[model samples]
Target: MDTAGFTNLLTRPGPYATVLADVSQDSDNAAHAKELRVRAACEELSAQGAPPDVVAEVSDRLAANVRLPAPAARVVVATPEGVAYDQVAVAEVPNQVATWDPLPDLGSWIAARDSSVSFVLVLVDHAGGEISLWDSGLPRPTSTTTVEGDELEHVQKVQDDVGWAAYRMQQTTDNVWRHNADKVAEEVTRLVRDHGHDLVLVGGDPHSVSRLRDVLADQPVEVVELESGQRAADGGEEALHDAIRSALMDRVVRQRTALVRRLEEAWGRGDRAATGVRDVADAFVTGRVETLLIDPDALAGRTLDPADHPGLTFGEAPVSGPVEAGEALVAAAVLTDAQVCVLPASVLGDAPVAALLRWA
Candidate 1:
């Protein structure tokens, strides 16, 4: 779910197909068997009248995702005229029907690729810190950097000689923690500049996490302290994922709510909101749309002649469509680099598609 890679698939003209298959290997022949299954899926596309070249490329790409070593799952996306996007198993799910949709149904993919949303998770303690960059939406951290320092451990009680030693150890730990934070902040700034992650998550030693915020004060990113065990500790991934999952769930809904509010505000003022498919399509033609919103289940596979129906134009020629209305609007969203948001059926009310326009 690298943004650029996804944009290619989403914005392109169809006959694009998505194939999600179990590529897990159990035996010596497992890899070959997986290849055959994926290849067969591509053949099905060809049989369905997809371009021969596209099918061949798709097959090659799908095979590559599993390759010699087996994968847990595979998602293959191919467009006839554009580049193919193939990714190894990020999440384990059933072998969906080549998971084919007009455009690769990115909903699942986006949801599965947690790192795609752009965030930096820092796990820090007095001894060191770990920085995990979640920018490319890869199954693993796109990049990680660890900063190390003087060893520091807790002394539970302070009594006479033991108290003095404990206090000294604590002081050393504090200094090392402060130093580690500065170094971590420097690395974080570089990553933010290079990767553009907007959210910052911190977990680990509470004191380290607190010191981190002060050092990162000037960095332009939203930093949140998470309650969890550190990644370097046992069951780290699960703890990190649990916290991240909780954070993202709230974030996604808030984002959707904001988009809805934007749409409603524009409509209320009669400034530039396009409500319903017809108006939105017209907005696309005029290159007025800044955000494209749709109900994924509505108006699906519905086709209309540009000449006869309300046609959405992509701010260009072919001002109408015999193209499936849903697909056409998706293309328009991509063409204009507008944000594409799919809302649930109830949230969209009666509108199949809506647009927040760039201009009235």
Candidate 2:
């Protein structure tokens, strides 16, 4: 996940109040449930010595998403100024955390965002396609568009004749199909490029799928040709939705695996790698980290004194006290434009944090 989103929280002064909680609007009493959750979070922040103004701001911000259904959890970080960083997280928060700390508890927020995937789903046929940009765990697409190709007769195969004249007719039909596919591919590419889409799912007509894959072969994003689905209304059929979700999850797994493999290879060479709290923190502070792999549980309760790292890039305010090590490291990573990937507990053995640095 890109840590740049934390610029607001990092640039402002803290004792920041970070709240991670369930904000799902699926139930009939969703408004009340959400209010209750917001109330609880606010009360906790108050108990943690957060200012009333900050607590009120956090409450209002958390409750503002009552109408957005599933991807039930949200993470909000607020300084006394107002809400700073707010984003919808993965489907659930098994354990909600509310804290007022020297630095925001960013590991939880990062973990939640890391669990989700963003991609473009193109349901195509020979004549056109429906393109929707989606994020896994969210109920509706962020954007939806339809790409229709030129109006041409006979955009499909016809085996009625075999003469030269017949071949000419078939060639025209093939051209129409390819032309339409190109139209859809162009739109898909634009959406992926503009949105920084992680994956592209192409489904529907097999020929159309093949053409789209061909056109998108050189793009940096991954293109997964789904085995099912067609152009339809807002949400595709249940089975199609399931297939897309599965593809997104599979991509997540593959990406995490690849990240771990890269770290392992770099570690084996004993270069471009930093492990344990102090080394990883130093790397982040110096802007040397390319990817910061954090095990939230491993780093829980750890602290980093600002005086120890005089050049910390978190905010303009001077050091007040020790900050949560995970939060401090993540803040530094964000300021330096590094990626943060949350690992499962203990995946890094006893090391609370590990990093693949830009240089040795």
Candidate-wise lDDT, in order: 0.67, 0.81
TM-score of each: 0.75, 0.91
lDDT of 2 by residue, 1-360 (tens): 887777766777777899998888776687687788889989999998999999888888888754465647888888878888887744667678899987778787677778778789899888789999887757788899988887666444356644765677778878998999999999888887888886899899889899999999999978898867877564368879788878888888888898888888988899998988788877766778999999887788888886676566676534567878888888788778889998864556458888989999
**Which regions of candidate 1 are displaced past 4 Å?**
1-3, 6-40, 65-83, 88-116, 135-138, 150-173, 235-237, 304-321
Lowest summed lDDT over 10 consecutive residues: which window, candidate 2?
Answer: 153-162
Most accurate candidate by lDDT: 2
Q: Write the per-residue lDDT of candidate 1 for residues 1-360, one digit (tens) a residue.
A: 223445555446565676666666657687678777877787777666767777777677666633323336666777766445777644554334453344454443433443236678888876778998874334567778987765556656656588687778878777867887777778888988898777888888887788888888888888888878584658377877888877766666677788788877877898878777677777777788887777655766565455643444433223333656665666666666777776655655467777788899
Model 2 residue 185 CA deviation (Å) reads: 1.2
